[model samples]
Each structure stands twice: as C-alpha cells, then as structure tokens.
Target: MTLIHPAEDLGVLRFITAGSVDDGKSTLIGRLLYDSKAVLSDQLSALARAKHKRTAGEDIDLALLTDGLEAEREQGITIDVAYRYFATAKRKFIIADTPGHEQYTRNMVTGASTAHAAIILIDATRVSEVDGRTELLAQTKRHSAIVKLLALPHVIVAINKMDLVDYSEARFDAIRAAYLALAQRLGLQSVRFVPVSALKGDNIVTASERMPWYQDEPLLDVLESLPVGEVSGSAAELRFPVQLVARQDGSHADDFRGYMGRVEAGAISVGQALRVLPAGHRATVAEIIGPRGELAHAHAGQCVTVRLAEDVDISRGDILVAAEATVEPARKLSADLCWFDHEPLSSQRKYILKQTTANVFARVGSVDSVLDVGTLSHGQHKGTLEMNDIGAVQISLQKALVCDTYEQHPATGAFVLIDEATHHTVAAGMIRAFTA
Candidate 1:
C-alpha cells in the first residue's frame, strides 16, 4: 500500500463515484483511502470502534468512513454527497461520493457537474443471468447520461466486486463490452474499464494477483495517468462576471475604481480590451491587482480587481468579456433543465433564475422534450416535468443576460432556478442556445 514516486506537479483531479444503490461507492473510496495510506491511524481505529460490521467476519466496514449522517449509517446508504481528499505520490484526488438512488439523481448531477472524471461502479453479480436475460440497472446508465450531459471528458467504468463473480475474465469482458456501447452512444470521450474488489483492496491502489487477466494498470494508476483537465482554462474565451464594483471604500487608493471578480474563463492582460456585457461598454484593462498586489495579467480561476482605462457602468450582475470573443446577450434562452421540484414545472408559473453573479425573473416559455431515461431518447411531450426529470425548456428572462452554450464554456453556461415562494433551488440548468 505504500506508494513512492516523485511528487506530482499536477492539478488535483476531482472525480465522483456513482452507480445504483449499494454499488459500493463509499466502500470503494474508503478502500482507496486505506490502501493509499491516506487514512489516519485514529480513523482506522474509529472504524473498528463502530459496530456496523459489513459481515460476521472482522472486516471493518469500509463504507462507514464516508456515511457521515446517522440516517445513512442506520440505513447504510449515502443520502448526500460526501467529499473526501487524498493524495498519492503522483497525484492528489478529491472524491465526491454521491448518492446513487433514483430519487437522489440531483445529488449525482450536482457532484458530476464539477468533476473532471466519473468512476461509475457496477456490481458484477448483476451480469450473471438468473433466467434467459439479465436485469440491467437503469441508474448506471442514468449516471453515465448525466456525466455525458455535464461534458466530463474522462470516464472509468469500475466493475466492482469482481471477487463476488469469481474474478472471471468472461464476466468482466461481457460487462465491459455492454458498457462500452452505452458509453459510446452517450458520447463519452475517453473510457476505460478496471475490475476491482473494493472490500478486499484488490486492484484499487495496486494490482491484484488474483485477477491476472486484467493486464492493464490498477485503478489508482489509471486515475493518476489520466490528464488533470482537458485544457488550460486560459485557452478558452475570457469570461469575467463582475461580482463587485470596488468603489466608495475608504482608502488612500480612493481612485481605485475597478471591477472585481474571478475570471471564469480565458485570460486577461493589461491593455486588453474588454466588452461590458449587456451594456456593450468597451474599456481597456489598465491594471490588475491580486491579494498580494499588482499582477501583469490574470487567467481563468484568478480573482483580481481590474482597473479599466475609463469609467464604465458595471454592476454586480454585469459581465466583462474579451472584446474579440464575446457571448450572446438574450432575454430568452433555450436550455436543458433538470427539474428538482416535487411538483411538475408549470409554464405559466414564475421562478428566479440565478446564473453566475446574476439573477433574473424567469418563466418557462415551453417544454420542448423530456429525456426518457429508460430508453435514453428524447420524446416526452408531457406538459410538465416532475422531479428528477430532464428536458429541453424555453425560458424567458425579465432582462437580457450574457451566456454561452454549456458545451462552449461550462462556467457561464450553467445556471439554476429558485422557487419564488419557498426560495429553494428548483432546477439546475445548462444553457443550450439563445431564443429568437
């Protein structure tokens, strides 16, 4: 379990574990933490102290490390996303262990939205035929679909509990073949398969001798070997949503009237012209100041105060974009929405739309199509989308907002809807295109 390598000079890979309930998401993560020497001695001792044993055998329930809630511990299921951090010699990792039940699909989406890769677990037992046919759990496909929808570039289908199926190569091959077809159809860019026994610590951080047929790298090796991200954020279009207008604050630098926000995409340098969104006011970047002090330029993910050559009417909701590569501003937007409310979405009802650094009153113009999770097709003419339903929707915002399609740039292309009465997040949205 002790891994030694040169220190990883790479960005952390944020990944999430997803599949059907009891697919061993938390257990797989716990095994990774344990085998990689990431868990502390006290934590292992605490795991022993907890009475929730996986079996009569003395194997400490690995799942307990992440099932933090009492209900989750009692029911032995993950209800919400549990975040855990660990590092190998070659790379660091942030794992989001999300719930896998059908009702909690929203939690899966929330976790997948930020992840660079997804580790979709599958119980090998399911592949064994009880009758003439085998029952395939829809949740696995559901998670894969969501992963594809989020545009995640890396995907690993973890055929977990290989030991249960006697570590048979035929079984593993059958499952992998079926999964590859689904993965390709769902538009997954990169896909790999690894047979793992999370409970026995097989093929987790290190290769397992029992599964000699799996000639490829172990799970950890595959994860560390994968690229951190598809590309550098600075390579994309410059998207700076102005969160604060730094003015009127008492300081000797009273003349410091600058727009302050994090760069969501692309890069900005001094003297680079930026277009104020919605207003279309143009200005050149005169100075960029970070917490330490002046910066010659800034890239995506950097939060800096940008001083413009001329005063422009910039507000909290306004965005500053690279003049050469700008976004479309529209009052009406077409988007794919995951309905989170218990009640179906009504086209006549109103909701509050919260995009990056901005809010607007919005109403559903129409429901174009609802995704059929069972069939993996689109064609639900149903007027309303119930909870856990995803569909294309046309929305009309009270005011024009600047946005790019989710495929173009994830940062500015994503948004959420809040209920007007209850003030709860009702839906998660990904912009598709601007409506005419």
Candidate 2:
C-alpha cells in the first residue's frame, strides 16, 4: 500500500476539526482526502469491501476512512484523535479529526493545542429558530470555548449537512448571525463561515453551484489562503530552554562547553549578550554549531549547540534570554488548568509539572473558578476538578521557575502535570501570572 506525503518544499498548514457527535466532521475530512486524490487504490479497495459501510450499496461510506477503529466503526463515532495528511497543488495540509463527544473534551483539547486553525462543524438540523432566537447545541459552545482558550489563529465554522436542509440560505444566515454573537463573546478572532455538505461534496474543494447566494472562497481555498503567522523564524522574543549541556575534555587546549537546545522564539547570533535564567548569570554567545556545522546565526525552530564566551554554571532546564530582558524566578503561579485524567484533581496531591525542559514538584494551592462551557462564564469552583473540567488555580512549586505568560510566549508558558506515582499526564496548564 503506497502512502502519499506532501512535497517537502511546499508550505504546510495544520488544522483540527471539531463538532458535536454526528456532526459529519469525519465525513468532511474523508471527502477532503478522497477528492484531493490522497487515497491509494489498495485503501479504496479495502474501503469498498468493508463491512461497516454506512452509505447505500456501491456508494462508499467516506466517513469510514477516518473512523478506523473497530469499535468506532461499529458505533459510528470518533472517540480518539485521528490525524490525516494531504496536499493540493497550492499547499500541504495536516488535519486532526478530533472526537466530538462532551466526554472526550480532553481529546479535543489535546488535538487543538498545536493547530494553527480549527474547523468547527455545526449540524444544520440540530439548530433552529425559537421565539425569534437561534439556539445552538451545547457541544458547539463547548468546543468553541476551547478553541478560544487555545488562542487558535483562525476559525472556520462549517455548517454541515446543507443538503439535508435543502440548502436554505435563510437557515444559514440565522446560524451565522448566532455564531457571530458567540464568537464576539468568546473573543474569537478571524472567524469565517461556510455552508457545506460533506456527504455530497458541495463547497469543500470547489465552489458549489447549489449555494449561489453564498459567494466566498470554498473551504479549501480559505485554508490555503489563511495567514499562518509566525510559524517559525519570526522576530518574537528569544527563549531557549536548555535540553542538554555538551562538554568535552576540559584539559584540552580547544575544549568544548556548549549548551544544546532548539531556539523556541527569536534569533540568536555570535557575540550577542545572553543571561542565564533562574541564576541571572550573564554571558556572550561565541559559537553556534548546526547540523551542517558552524552557523553564525540561528532563529526559532533551529536546533543547535551554542558555546558561551564565559562558561557560567548552566544545566538542563535552564533558560537563556536576552541580557536586557526582565524575568523573575517565582515559586507560585496563577494558571488556567485543564484536567485530563480520569481521577479528579485534589489540592493535597502532588504532581510533577513539566514545562519546556524543566520538571518540578507542584501542588494546587487553590481552585479559584471553573469555566461553564454552556454559559461561557466562570463560576465558583467546587474545590476539585473532574475529567474534562477547566479551572483557574494557584499552584505552588518546590523550585522557582522563570517563564512568560502564555499569551506572550507559549513555549515557556505552557506545562503538563504528571502523576508522580503512575507517570501518567494528568493535566495541561497555561501560565497567567507569577505570584509570591
């Protein structure tokens, strides 16, 4: 079976699909891959003979392409996050097909954490006008809230199953207006709406003649044209988390004492002044060694070993920043925590907080508030967090950590909590403020 991968020279776009259960997200993605000719003949043949075909005879069930698990196929639902890759002539794309159930909210959050955009599908039949007001599903609000929390650069609201509604323009308009209101409330920027029928392949890869009133670029065009801002190599602040320290023969005339890591944010060059974080020791960059040997300069996303003019004490988990930057080492943090484990979070339990290359013991000092997805509001916390619950909390750490707010630099601002006993990841956190 041959697999098709995107060309190396083309720009890549990574996005995730989210919606309520049975909202046709899998079908939309399957149709996208199929129409783009990413599927191979052997895979198509297997799909044709598959026993869990949902479509009528001789017509393949495109959704089967994404719902790969035995149980998912039988249940006609997506449970885990599924990733698919395809490319058009213009751009390469990575699509994360995330689960839609409320119970799988954690899975959706995991899928969206690294995505540049999110395609939120809204089932047409499930929404309607009541008392001169348009009402949407709870899952729709829940997923949208998560997208806002993640600060995804773009949002594409795909009103799916348009064919089922006879492609009504008024129905689409009402849903669009209601969604716009929700987006404004959640502070979601760069939101675009499109009406589509994933099953019938209308307005997915090409323009749909059926919806002549809807005059805009199709879904694929919107995706190809969306600005993927600062993917890498941008002028953002410098943040280098030391993953390893390379050393060689100290007694030798030409000794090596280099700090090795990926440049998470801005650029770095030889002779540039740098300050070692948590220690506040200052040094100057002397050399940078890339995969191809010596490099005079390096930017974000480039992994290299850097030699310092003065070798101050440095180790793994130490951060290097600009000399003039203001950073404080704090033992307490105000953060937004998303609980992902089956076991509820207890304030008395201790977990290892893993951020960038640093790992430190941490415990929940207080659960301040819990997010109400239904209302898009924060309510008083009940003192503990269940699975898929998000809340604002104060965390106390065993050691001081130097970092930035999530809105400023996501690399150093985000972290995950690991249960010390089981070594399982329990939650994801975003830093908001440093406290005493």
lDDT of 2 by residue, 1-436 (tens): 2333455234678999999999999999999998878899898988989999898888888998889899899999999999998877767789999999988888898999989999999999899677999988988998898898788889999999999999999899999999999999989989999999999999999999999999999999999888765545433368889999998998998889999999988888889898898899999999999999999999887899999999699999999988877777789999998899999998889999999999999999899999888787887568988888889999999999988888887888899999999998999988999854
Clashing pairs in 2: none
lDDT of 1 by residue, 184-238 (tens): 7777868999999998989998999999888999999998888875333552388
How much is 10 displaced in model 2, in angstroms? Answer: 7.0
Which portions of model 2 show Cα errors greater than 4 Å?
1-10, 128-130, 231-236, 248-253
Clashes of 1: 0
Give each model's whole-structure lDDT.
Answer: 0.86, 0.89
Give the TM-scores of the predictions, in the order they appear. 0.95, 0.94
Worst 10 residues of 2 by lDDT: 1-10
Instruction: Note the residue pairs that clash in candidate 1.
Output: none
Instruction: Report how far residue 150 has shifted in candidate 2, in Å.
Output: 0.9
CA RMSD of each candidate after superposition: 2.3, 2.7
Backbone N/Cα/C clashes per model: 0, 0
Q: So what's the TM-score on candidate 1?
A: 0.95
lDDT of 2 at 159: 99
